[model samples]
Target: MSAHVPQICVMGVSAAGKSTVGIALAETLAVPFVDADSLHLESNRTKMAAGTPLTDDDRWPWLDAVGAEYAQAGASGLVMACSALKRVYRDRIRAAAPGVVFVHLGGPRELLLERATARTDHFMPSSLLDSQLDTLEPLGDDELGVAVTVDRTPAMLVSEIIERLRA
Candidate 1:
């Protein structure tokens, strides 16, 4: 039988270091890394760049695209970075990839806002941080994943994630 290949989504609100931790985790696990932001339509990116929060209608297609990536990863597995702030969104991804696990990175709003404000290259604006925070639904007890506090270095965070995932 083939070895089990892990599919992981590193999720959280904006500026919670989803991309950074996802990248590090992918490297450590020897999997392909995908930043789900890259799957957003240009129109959605434009709306977010203007500091407008996306409506649920605006996000459905993008969320499906993220799910498609997970489905396409197949035996190769994948590590994805996405702001899966709502339970429905995570459920959407799970529908596409049943074996996928989530790693939720959570931190204080102040720290998230501070990090969002410091970013220069991302399309998301600090103004939308509150919206993201308001929309966040943490992982449930029955979910196949772990919620981690983002209070340490990326290396440290990745280590903790690895340990917890193995547990």
Candidate 2:
């Protein structure tokens, strides 16, 4: 089972580099990648774009669908970029695939807000940054396999993850 490849959820609040690092990692691993934001309903996107935070109830189904897609992928692993801020959200993913590994892209909130502000036309607005940060849960020390922060370059981040997986 050393080659056991679980779906990788590149998770964190907005602007934490989930999508950036996930795509690079997917390319390096030659696996398919999913931008979890793409699965959001138009209404959810609009709400967030309007600077409204979505409740957990509103996010449950959307999260489920992303998990379902990877669960359906069989042997091939998938990398998903998402702001799975709450432990309950992570729990849902675990329920779908026990082997799913979450790579939390975490860092200083001010840095994230700055990045969010610089981005254009994104669904998540800078206004909700604090709430996103509030909802974040750091991985427990013995949780699973590799869990990393967004403090490094994309290549470095991907390299660290690949090394962890290989070990």
Between which residue pairs do clashes occur in model 1?
Answer: none
Clashing pairs in 2: none
Give the Cα-based TM-score of candidate 2 against the true structure.
Answer: 0.93
lDDT tens digits, residue span 38-83, model 2? 9988888989888889988889889888778778875798888988
Enumerate clash totals for all models, in the order shown.
0, 0
Quote the positional error of residue 164 for candidate 1 in Å. 0.3
Off by over 4 Å in 1: 1-3
Q: Which ten residues in a row have the lowest lDDT in candidate 1?
A: 1-10
Error of 2 at 111 (Å): 1.5
TM-score attained by model 1: 0.96
Work out candidate 2's RMSD over C-alphas.
1.6
